[model samples]
Target: MKGGATVPIGLTPEQGQLQEAVGRFAARHAAVDQTRDSFEALAEGALPKWWNDLVSHGFHAVHLPDGVGGQGGSLLDAACVIESASAALLPGPLLPTVIAGAIVLSVDDMAAAKLLSELAAGATATVVLPESGDLSATATDGGWRVTGASGDVLGVRSAAVILAAARRDDGETLWFVLDPEVASASVEQRDGTDLTIDVGMLRLADHVVPEALVLNGIDDDAAWDITVALSACASAGTLQWAVDAVTEHLRTREQFGKPIGTFQALQHEAAMLLVNSELAAAAAWDAVRAVAEAPEQRQLAAAGAAIMAVAPAPELLLDALTMFGAIGFTWEHDVHLYWRRATSLAASMGPITGWSRRLGELSKTHVRDMTVKIGEAEADFRAGIAAVLDEALGLVNDKPSPLGDYDHLASGPQRTLIADAGLMAPHWPPPWGLGATPLQQLIIDDEFAKRPELVRPSLNIAEWVLPSIISSGSEVVQQQLIPPTQRGELLWCQLFSEPGAGSDLAALSTRAVKVDGGWRINGHKIWTSSAQYADYGALLARTDPDAPKHKGIGYFIIDMRADGVEIQPIKTADRDPHFNEVFLADVFVPDEMLLGGPTDGWSLAIATMAQERVAIGAYVNIDRAIALRRLAAQRGPDQDAVVRALGELDAYTNAIKALGVRETIRLLDGQSAGPASSIAKVATSIMLRRTFKATLELAGPLAMVERSEPAIVAPYLRLPAELIGGGTRQIQLNIIAQMIMGLPRK
Candidate 1:
């Protein structure tokens, strides 16, 4: 969590320091044994000394203001501490205490303030709402009589002070504080799955005669927001522990004389668990930060937290246990303990169905706001671009719409007008681009997004290839290629993948012999998308057979019209001829066409591949998730199997969308996409496969016959291409593990 020049998404440097500090504290005082001992002590009507130690050490009051006998820090700081403590299996009273402290601090009750100061120093508190109890209170002369029962309240018996919400005769909910020690309250301990915290039922019979103890004003929204945020942090922390534990078990547990982790199935499963943990972490941090910085965004953030934390934590823990084999099932192992804790927390979170629906409802409006952060100038830029687009829309209004399958406008007056204005390639350098800053680029995106019908010409690889070429290609190559590519006058396809070398492109046998002021290329490329329609291709060939696989390569721009260059369509499973195989028998490339150094194709290819992955990862289609959800809603969730499948698809699809937002935010911040893009690419592919499969399943008999819903059946058939294209899912996982996770290669 420690930040450098570039911090991870949703976290700042100070938050990182807080996370590190809490991690160290957890390592020392909140391990598995400590958690077990805390449970044992609770059974004996004793509280763990660690709670007081935390208060004494100032960790308890980190989120409170200095005037309240605490350190003034953001809620994000509090969430970090909670996350780290949860990772160590720390008990739950601290979580409830921190949340209650925040709520009490927001009101103007002197009695509550005194109790909060005590909580900041060492005391623990619990808040029980209507969801947790049947509690009710009535106002009397100078005091209130409270009588109700609260069930499934964690740490209720252990907390010295309790905050309970009850409805009056007027149907209004009021918040009151109860001093359990002084009040006539009885606590009955209940057998629960989570051994780390004492869950019990609390009954108050005509107790709490004190108007002074009632908070002046109660904001249930603020209370729930704080609780949800802290609970999400705990879930994130525990999920991380489970993921790490399972990962370590996989690395060490061997089967058939080899480590189980070597198996691709286990690798993918572990990688998925890691992905879930990441989503939880990102969501939790976002929620906490929203609480600290933007109160308006709190509901959206809490919804994200509710969906991510409650839905995934238990499942991830169960996955970890499954990965651990029979040992994980045994009582002696700690995996089951984590599973029990997760299940208990999930139950307390109520129905996943409601939270999932809430998330879906919030996504439409909230996600757009979270995608980018723009300043005043960028806002002005957007307005200016909007005016220009309005004018451009006028130009296309009366003209015959030539946007048919065979007659789409690629290069016409409409495209030419926009391209000339530098809107086509805003990120590219001047003459061909505006060299717009990240904010300006986002502004361009905002403007172009308004006109969905005005399609930008698919320059294919030229979008990425042209930029790489501009950076490294000779002046002649840049001047001749950049302008035309920008103007949509040129169409290009990449010719890097060969039949013998798809993922292993460096091992390609494509030979390029140096000739008189040119090179004779003799090679074959396969699975080239749109190769049949390309005017030219960005090609890779071996110039030195003696050099190593990655070192002996050269890149060139080969004209598709050259002699001996034959293109044959490769029919896919969908019966589409969009992909083609090209045989370069003896194609000649002039010396000026060579890109970068002779032996530098590998480096350039890596650069290009990186950009490709980013592009693929950033391809967020909002309609895709919505369509699947609509399909599920039509099918209904009456059957458990269908409901399970639909829920899984929805969760994964939403996660992909979240990952896209993170990636876009990173781009807008001018940060490197790095290996994380592979993570997103892999997640997207998996989500797509599952989503389409679930769609078909939901359709039942209707799926057998092709319908006009080309969006559904067409994508299902073409999904294999996506899984194989832009690196296979397995290859992406390898990159994620090796490059991002730093796991040793096979």
Candidate 2:
């Protein structure tokens, strides 16, 4: 993927232009050789000329208030600038200086205000985070005495002032802006993994600091949040570069007479790296927005960024290293350079355990009722839709139940009411649907969400099957069934896989014979969900036995109640009979029931499967994610192990949600689903397994005794089905390799 290949995660057009400009500057000034030279220069207490250029550009003042003599931009702007710099491997004091400026500008005191101006004017700054060992400050006659030591302080060598947190005698943490040149300190340069940046140890003796240098009311938590958010942004940019670099390698590098990217294994690895990169991007972007727009949720967002990006950055980079093969091991390749920076950034944020525990504690209480702003036009559209839905709900309630006490939503006046209001399938075209755009579709869901009591009718199989039918099914079939299906007048099932065919659907042995007025079908379909209750099925059978396997297949709409159709319930691990085996013995189907043509079933199946992937992959199971958090909160205090797992589950769940949001945006932009779409099912499968395992672990002895939480334990028994259903994880990977990555088929 290129720079603009996918939309820059959370940037506006203006910010994107800024990013491009910074990128061009970095390209000219921060080449690999230049980075090495700057590192050496910083070690000798000399500033590189490019550092002044950056300051002149106002990159260091992006997060500061204009009233304090700095640019009045949001934290998001600072994030973008640092991200661009990090991507080019620019060695600088930008991150720390920007963070320090934020703190100084936050206070209204004259001294703090004056410091903010100096910072914005390009005075270099370094930070010693709260996670560093206790640095104490005690009040003296007219000043304060500070004493402590911090290791691995980035930009310390070139920093004019150091921003640090120290505990006072009253047990309150105070933010102090100390001039390294003014204090008695020893700054020794140290060698580290990332060679492009300057880092060193700072030893501060018991020295007196003037009262003007100390800023009151700066909470330790607030400072930590700022540092984590900024570091995450920088790390995210580096990881993205790794992703693109590795991708470029796979595209051009060849092995054994073909491009190595043609291999399925490599494609799957690249796909996962892409997933991690997106997750990091979303996390960093969301964190900065939280700090700027929703201060109340800032802690939660910062912790989420750590859990999602900071902790995983190093590992993702290592994976990228693996993709680069032996050549990446050498220093010349720049892979090791990124790996070092990733690890260094992770270390700077402190231990992952502490972050996870904080995240767990926060997740236990946070409701996560997040809503992204989609502009005033979208807002008005949502309001109108909400009013319409409110009226529809009142009308439905006034009428008697057309379900006739059946208590099911598959059919009845309730379904009819929703269908009449064009709410049944808003994504579909008019009459049957409202032809809603992606954003409009979201707005519709938002309205429906407000009415939790009103059940949205669904035809489980028709969710994707009906869409496929409308796209390729004959006009008669669409006209006859689509409206009824939308109205909840008919239920549908799918019969595309046989026991012997499973992932290899084209090898199905089911046979369809053409007759004078219809086709005679004889086939056996297994693992069909809701088959016994289905009124119809989107069936796939062989029409031309002599042709190739895929070319001979045809798709049709078969009446489940037709003569010679046998449906036998198959008990699953949970002992529920939702799945069934259908055996068709010369089942007769009218020619009108055929979808597309006799030789188009394979293509139709592909389209339907893609839709299925999108539907399943984009569905965020917020309830499940929240339930785990609740369990962690309710568990015994001694259950630290389970709490850690709970935190991990929370992070993974949020990651899935973030990935879904990206996919939705991609679709809204009219970009077709790519490799990310293919791997979503795979990623979700892994997430489910981890979630269930954590739930069971949290349950402990309770799971072994009698019946446990049905929602938690039962899913374990059905986990294998999820991995195998829709398509096996391996099959999905193969699709990603061949279709999305352009790999040659085996």
- Alpha-carbon lDDT, every model: 0.72, 0.75
Clashing pairs in 1: none
Q: Which ten residues in a row have the lowest lDDT in candidate 1?
A: 1-10
Residue 357, candidate 1: Cα error in Å is 3.6
Off by over 4 Å in 2: 1-7, 37-39, 42-46, 65-72, 102-105, 141-143, 293-296, 375-380, 392-411, 474-476, 545-552, 625-631, 634-637, 663-676, 709-711, 741-746
Model 2 error, position 268 (Å): 2.2
- Report the C-alpha lDDT of model 1 over 399-457, residue by residue, as the tens digit: 32222253233566666667777777777788677788877887887677767876654
Superposed Cα deviation of residue 657, candidate 1 (Å): 3.8
Query: Distance from true position, residue 496, model 1, in Å?
Result: 2.6
lDDT of 2 by residue, 291-395 (tens): 654454777677778888888989898898988898988867888888888898888888888777777776776734356445555777787778777766664
TM-score of 2: 0.90
TM-score of each: 0.86, 0.90
Clashes of each: 0, 0
Task: Please report the candidate that would top lDDT against the real structure.
Answer: 2
